[model samples]
Target: MTRRRPPRHASADELLTELGRLTQQALERAELQKARVELAEALQRELLPAELPELPGLRAAARYAPARHGLNIGGDWYDGFPLPDGSLAFSIGDVQGHDVEAAAFMGQVRIGLRAVAATAADPGQVLSRANDLLLSMDTRLFATCSFLRFDPATRELSHARAGHVPWVWATPDGRWGLGEDEGGLPLGVLAEESYPVTRRVLPASCAFVLVTDGVIEGPAFPITAGLDEVARVTRAGVHAEPAELAAAVIKVADLTGHADDAAVLVLRHDRPPA
Candidate 1:
């Protein structure tokens, strides 16, 4: 006699309960992740300048690329704003971490540094003050930054670097070299240390390139090779305007496998000879 198969268990309520719990958990996780992403993106946007500062008699352009590897954007940032003395204040920096908190801290440091730079008029002093500010704050992040006070009249670039990548300059004659700035310490580090400012007399038709370490520190190439590529690209675009040159350099950097967040700012001196 064929035994009647035990009636299939029909616990629809129990099944529905399990499914509801799973769905609720999934929704909660999705909401948390979305909130985190939004927070990180907002912080990054706040850290960067909304628009490049207006400078009379000079043309400037910038390119920023966030890394493609994570939920939180990296800390690379570029900024340009007019100093109270009428000179252009230009800078690029990267905090050590990449997250919402890092971005927020970076925004605070960037604004504070700009104010300090305006008042101090000395890059080293400004950085020192920024370090003190960082130490006083709850955030314990560090960053490498380069600051330049550009004079359109004399084509002089007064610059200082705090553990950031060295800048490059391409003269009108096609000669290219690093813009070497002397002693400096990264912000949010030792308060007693100071940075040395270096001045460069750019050619009337020169192009100066500033960048963050993300362009040069990733895999597939060493930092030196990345710099060499930059030098090459700057020479190739020697005849282009600052904005055009910056675009070209950014393209080349991306092609060379810059997998991290990267930024480039180009300054082209075009004042007619007085």
Candidate 2:
């Protein structure tokens, strides 16, 4: 049997040098991650609408908050604008992720919805066309959305949902209820999903609330209870301004310690001047 040579051992100085090099590399990687996170946050801010439009008799306000325990970026988004035919459109959605890619995809979805709504007559058509648009994109992510078209002249509210949570509304008489409307599959799930529209006449001086799941559901909170709590809050603030009501609704997420991003949109209808 051949005798093996004595094992050569590294000197302490050489080991210390290697340790220092590793430590430097770790610090550099941490800095790089921080820079990337900052960029993502900036992109998210740019993707969201800076201000909601205020129509003649309708007032709108929206609020958004990042998760308390993540990269501080997510796919939750809310938008409101006037359509070409003098109707106002509002949308709230959550893309399936909590990263930079999700935020970018959210922007794309919002743009697609706007393009489709420009000519689409009702909420259902807008969501259907937008769903097709999302499927055509080279992405596997999906999203849930609630789209609404309000005709101020008739007080008619047309809504369509795509695997999204129920909306809450409060009438001027202090009565509140959840939407619980029929919905289609989430966007990007199928090639051409048809979202059925639900039409109802909103009472004058009514408050309509739309929110992402993050606002109502948490690890420690059940969704049913959360929905009830939101309804109660809406009832209490039925007479408040749209901005105040939006703030009050978003505050629920902070109290629940939710781990996902939260978004809330409040639309209040006041009878046009008498």
Candidate 3:
């Protein structure tokens, strides 16, 4: 004899009612998630600088954009701190992931870099020590950073980059150049890699624009396209103030399709007061 199939567990109406209940539960859960995300975004915004440092003979501005995912708050930070010798240390960095954990790690990385910079007084050495510190931390997390040491008195600037984007320097003579660094892998990935150091004497009226990759990549435009757009927009306004220039570049990214968090730091040397 043929075996009979088992009876349906629930009638059509019953199934629909169950599904409605499930949907309500999911909606409630989503509401909770949204609240958490709002809280996180507010907290992350607090971490960002209230105001860019006001250094004599310089104009500086910074911007940090949070990812649209809502749950992902990647640590994209810029800071200007002073070293023991009175030189200003400027830096921008991004921790690997976009979440609460990443934010915390970014804070730690910033602190470690500051400590190393104060102790070493060399751009390359500071990054090297930061690399070691990252390697010692959680193995999965990594960070890309660009560190700058600027001496306003002497008009000297030294830099080191770790897998970060190229910094653009626009000159008073209407020429633009990319900052040169030997470059190395992002921190926390390798145990003993070394970062290269480079220096330059920024001209009066010259400005350096440093940015994170989030300013460039998304679904509509590829990374190269975003970068090219940045170059084009930035090259167009080489004489604008640091803040205006940064806003211009970021507006292009926003228009293009920068889904992830983006950060831009502008440092321009100006004439000293009489």
The most accurate candidate by lDDT is: 2
Instruction: Please say which candidate is ahead in lDDT: 1 or 2.
Output: 2
Candidate models: Cα lDDT each:
0.78, 0.88, 0.80
The number of clashing residue pairs in each candidate reads 0, 0, 0
> TM-scores of all models?
0.84, 0.91, 0.90
* Model 3 per-residue lDDT tens digits across residues 1-274: 9999988789899999999999999999999888776765675676666776656887788877777776666568888787898788888988888777777777788888888887998888898899998888756889999998888778888998899888777766768766656788888888788888888776777778888878877768776677677767667767787878888877755865666678888887886866
TM-score, model 1 to reference? 0.84
**Where in model 3 is the C-alpha error above 4 Å?**
2-6
Rank the candidate models, highest lDDT first: 2, 3, 1
- Candidate 2 root-mean-square deviation in Å: 2.2
Candidate 2 lDDT by residue in tens digits, 29-66: 98887776676677778999999887777899999988
Q: Is candidate 1 or candidate 3 better by lDDT?
A: 3
